[model samples]
Target: MPKEREWLTFYDWARTYGNYFYLSILGQPILVLNTHDVVSDLLEKRSGIYSSRPRLVMAGDLVGFDQAIALMPYSERFRQLRRLIQRELNAKALEKYWPLHEQESRELAKNLISHPTEMQSYIRHYAGSVILKVTYGYQTQPKDDPFLLLAEKVMQAFSMASQPGAWLVDLVPWLRYLPSWSPGAGFQSTAKKWSDLHMQVINGPYDWAMRNQGLPALAKPNFVSTVINQTDADLTEEEQSLLLWSSASLFGGGADTTVAALSSFFLAMALYPGVQQRGYTEIQKVVGKDRLPSVSDRKHLPYVECIMYEVLRWNPVTPLGVPHMLVEADVYEGYHIPAKTIIMPNIWAMLHEPSIFPEPHSFLPERFVGNEAAVKEVSVAFGFGRRACPGVAFAESSMFVAIATALSTVIIANARDMQGKDITREVPYKTGTISHPPAFTCSLTPRDGAELLSIRT
Candidate 1:
C-alpha cells in the first residue's frame, strides 16, 4: 500500500531513484514519472496511447458506467463531451462569464473583509457559486444551499472512492459479485445513492429551464439551460442525464481544485513574505491602487503571474493527476509497459525534482521571472497530454484575478503564536485524494483606506 504521507513518500522515492520508477500496489502495475522530460515524452508526445483512464471497476460499474467523461476511454462519446465542454468553457466562452466571475469575486472580497475568520468557507462558497452559476444558472446564497450541499456530498464520495485503499474491490474484481449484505457492501450502496442524487440535482434544474425556454433569455446564462433549450436533438433520457452529469462533473472537478489552489496561494504568501512583498510591490506599481485587475492585465503583471505558477508547483492540488491508461503495449528505457496498463505522472516528484528546481523545497517565484522556459515547466502542474484540464483558461483567469486583488489590496499575515512568534508553521494538512492544506488562520488587513474602499467597491 502507498504510505499515508503522500509528498514525503513520493519525495523519498524520487530522490533515491531517478525520474521514472515503477511499483506494484495491490497487484496493480503503477508507474511514477518524476521528471519533466519523461512526463512530456509520455503524456504529451505519446498522448495517443496515454490518454486513457485507469479502470475503476466499482465506480465505473456502479456509478459512471462509462458516462463520466473524465473516466471514459478516448472514444467518440468522450470526444463529443470534450467538444461540448470546450464550447462552453473555452477562452471565448469564459469571457462571456467574466461578469459573473467578477461579481462573485467582489462578493468574495466583501465577505472576507466582514468575516476574515471564515476565509476558507467563503472561498469555497465563492468558487462553488461561480461554477454553479456557469453550469446551472443559479447561485448558492446561504452556506447550506441544497445544491451546494449535494455537490459537496457527491465530491466527498468521489474523493473517498478515488483514494488508493478506499476499495478492495478495485484490486479484486471478483469481490464485486458478493451480496449487498456482505462486508464492504456499504461502498456499493453509497455509490448508488450518490449517483442517484447526483442525477436528480443535475437534471432537475435543466428540465425546469427547458420547460421555460420560450421565456426571454435568463438574466444569468446557464450552460445546461442553454444546451438543453438551444440544441435541436432527440436526445434520449439517458443521454440527457449523462450530459447533465458531465456538466456537474465540471463543478465537482473544478471547484475544489481552484479553491485549494487559492488556499495554497495564501499559505505560500504567509510562509514566504518576501515573495509576497515582491508580488505586492509589482501589482501596486503596475495596477496602481485605483481599480481591480483584469485578465488583460496578466501580460503586464508577470511577477504576480510567477507567484501563481510557484504556488501551483509548490503544492499541486492534484498531485497524482487523473491517472492515464495505456491503450497499446509499449516499451521505454527497456521497460515493458503492457496495454491497459495504468500510468500515473507523479507530479509531486516532477515539480520537486532537485536538479530541475534548485532549493526545490523553498517558495521562489523569481526563478520564473523573465524565464519563458521556467514558466512552461510550471504549467505541467496542470497535467499533460490530450486530457489536460480543458478549464485551464477559466482556472488561470480566476486565480490570476484573485491573487492580484489580494496582493494589491490586502495584507496577508500569519497569525501569531501563543509564544508571540509566527504560527503559520503550526498549521498542518490532511492527506487525501486531493491534497489540501488543513484550515489555517490568517489576517487579511487592508493596506490603506483607499485599498479597503477599492476592495469593497
Candidate 2:
C-alpha cells in the first residue's frame, strides 16, 4: 500500500479487481469498497453491520478521541451521542443559524480583503469561527484565537494519528503496553503530548460556555446552551460528559472538512476562469449587487449550487472516508466479509467514476445542472447511511453562502508572476486524510459596489 494518497492506489486497484477487494495485513482483514453500487449496497443497505468504527490505537485510545462520535463504536453510547448532535444540527434546527452563517460569510470576505495573501489561514479561521460559535457560543478573536489554535492542533494530531496503518500499535495492539524505555516506544511520548492537547480542546470551550451563563435574553442560543435548556438545571455525569465531548467533536467533524471544501473552491475558481465567470454571472443575475446572497436564495441560484457541488466532487474532503468496522460476518455475492474487518469506502473513486461522472477529472458544474438523479451521487462525498455526516445541512449552507458571497464581493483570480503570467498553471491538491489544495498564490480584488461586503445581520 502506498503511504500517502492511498485513495489513488485504491482507485487503481478498483479498476483491476472489480468493485470490491480484500487484503489481509498481519492477519487483519481489510475491505476496500470502490464503486458507488458496492458502497451503497453494503454501507447503506446493510448499515447496521457496517456502521461501527474500527479502533485506532493512536488516535482513539491513546489520544482519547474514542469519546468523539466519529471514532465511537456502534453501540448505545454511539446512538445517544449521534442523537444529541443531530438534534441541534439537523436541517430544520439549522434554520435559526442562517444569520450566523451569513455573518461569518461576510467576515470571510472582509478577512480576504484585508489579508488576501493569507487565504488559507483566513479560510481556516472562518470555518473554525462558525463551528465554535455554533457549538459553544464562543466567539473567535480576529487573529490567532486560542480556541482556533487549539482546534488546529487537534486536527493535526487527528490527521496524523487516525491515518490507517500509520502506527504499529494499531496493527499490533499489544505494543501499546510496551515500556517507554523500550525501542519503538517513541509513539508513547508523542501520544502523551497529543493527549494533553486533546483534553484541553475538549474541556476549554465547554467550560467557557458553562461560566458565561449570563448572556442577554436576546442572544441566540447555541448548541451547548440549547442542550442545557432542554434538560433541568441539574445534569447527570453522563450528560455533562456527552455534551462536552460531543461539542468538541463538532470541530473535528465540521471545521476541517469545510476548510478543505472552501480551499478547493478558491483553487477551482483560480484554475477555471470560465467556470468562475459563469458562477459570478449567475449570482449577479439571480442575486443582484444590492445585498449579499442569503441561504434562502440558494434554491433560485442553481448554477452557483452546481459550483458548490462541483467543488465537493472535484476533490472530496476525505478521499477515503473514516473507515467503518463490519460487525458479525456477512456474505454478499458469495464473498464472505469477516467480522471486525475494516471497511474503507474509496470515495475518491466513486466521485471520479467515469460511467457516473463523465470526464471525471474535469471541474464541470453542468454535470449536476437539471440532473436531480446525478446530484444524489455527490452526497457520496459526505458518506453513506448511518455514518453520513450529521452536519450536512450546516455544511451545505456554509459553502453556498461563502461561494455566493465571494463571487459577489471579490474577484478570485490566479496571482500574476513578474512576467504577468498566471502563477498556478496546474491543478494540484495536497494529499492527506483530508485533501486540500497546497497553498498557492491568488488575487482577490474587490468588485464593483464592493461596499456590500459590509453586510449587517
Scored by TM-score, the top model is 2
With a 3 Å backbone cut-off (N, CA, C), the pairs that clash in candidate 1 are none
Deviation from native of the Cα of residue 359 in model 1, angstroms: 1.7
- For residues 1-457, write the lDDT of model 2, one tens digit per residue: 5687899888888779988999988888999999889998999999999999998998888999888888888889888888999989889999999999999999999889889988889999999989888888888889989988988888878877887888889989999999999999999999999999989988988888888866642235689889888897777998998888778878789888999999889888887889988988998898787888889999999999999999999899998999999999999999988999999999989899888789999889999988886799999988888989888989999999999889888889875443556656455566667777666658999988668777453
TM-score, cand. 1: 0.90
What are the per-model C-alpha RMSD values against the true structure? 3.0, 2.1
* Regions of model 2 farther than 4 Å from truth: 216-219, 415-426, 455-457
Give the TM-score comparing model 2 with the true structure, all chains together. Answer: 0.96
Q: What lDDT, from 0 to 1, does candidate 1 have?
A: 0.74
For candidate 1, give the lDDT of residue 368: 83
Error of 2 at 401 (Å): 0.3
